[model samples]
Target: MLEQRGILVPEAVRGRITRRMDPHVMRDWFRRAFAAAAAGQVFGDE
Candidate 1:
């Protein structure tokens, strides 16, 4: 879903997930972080 949504996942979360997950397992935590940042920016702009 992340790739489909054009999201950029972070390397930190990616590394931690890789330690406990299969190399192909993908979580969208970084996308959530990015969304948080974008939301903050939008509020700041207002």
Candidate 2:
């Protein structure tokens, strides 16, 4: 989704996401990606 919008996902962030193992959290991030302008927005600040 970010790629479709031309937003680049940094390699470090990609690595972090790659290590993420929770399906619920991944689902939430996937939904949020549609509205996020940045990678940080997907996971929020929590």
Candidate 3:
């Protein structure tokens, strides 16, 4: 979703997301990504 919007997903952010263990949190991040302008926005303070 971020890619479709031309938002860049940095490696650090990718690593963080990839490192997540909770499926619920990951699912929330996926939903948030649909509306995020940047990859960081998907995780926020996480």
Candidate 4:
């Protein structure tokens, strides 16, 4: 799908993204993102 849209991911870029996208890291990122979103909602979106 990405290739069909002309979005070419270079090998280096792919490698870096994959390297950091471990289950633990991804979970941590999602947790932080969700926390931020919840905070924003509570704060009324400054």
Candidate 5:
């Protein structure tokens, strides 16, 4: 959706995220996601 709205560039999403998101928040989010995956939690199944 954001890509279609031109808010995100597909090729530059990684760099953009790093530049736009707070580093601490991003790190925390990644940690949670990884932990969930490791614990065998299924994503987007609700």
Candidate 6:
């Protein structure tokens, strides 16, 4: 069963966050910003 395999553990495999508190999007933005900065593009200041 899934429980025996730990596949049904109480872990967050998917989530929905508020627009203002979307950590996944924020992380992606940070990644893109860092990449842009590294490539000498104009990313906004922190």
TM per prediction: 0.34, 0.80, 0.77, 0.34, 0.33, 0.34
Using lDDT as the yardstick, the better of models 4 and 5 is: 4
Question: Which segments of model 4 are wrong by more than 4 Å?
Answer: 22-46
What is candidate 5's lDDT per residue for 1-46, written digit by digit as tens?
A: 2333343334444454557567775565455554353211211221
lDDT of 1 by residue, 1-46 (tens): 3434555446654455456544322233434544553323212221
Evaluate model 3: give its TM-score: 0.77
Q: How many steric clashes does model 3 contain? A: 0
Task: Rank candidates by lDDT, best first.
Answer: 3, 2, 4, 5, 1, 6
- Predict model 5's lDDT versus the native: 0.41
Q: Which residue pairs in candidate 1 collide?
A: none
**Model 4, residue 35: displacement in angstroms?**
24
Clashing pairs in 6: none
1-46: candidate 2 lDDT, tens digit per residue:
7778887888887887889999988888889899999988886553
Query: How large is the C-alpha RMSD of every model relative to the true structure?
Result: 9.2, 1.4, 1.4, 10.7, 10.9, 13.4
Decide which is better by TM-score, 3 or 5.
3
Error of 3 at 40 (Å): 1.8
Question: 1-46, model 4: which lDDT tens digit per residue?
Answer: 2333344545664555467747765565445444443322222221
Clashing pairs in 3: none
Pairs that clash in candidate 4: none
Between 1 and 3, whose TM-score is larger? 3
Off by over 4 Å in 1: 22-46
lDDT of each: 0.41, 0.82, 0.82, 0.44, 0.41, 0.36
Model 3, 43: alpha-carbon shift in Å? 1.0
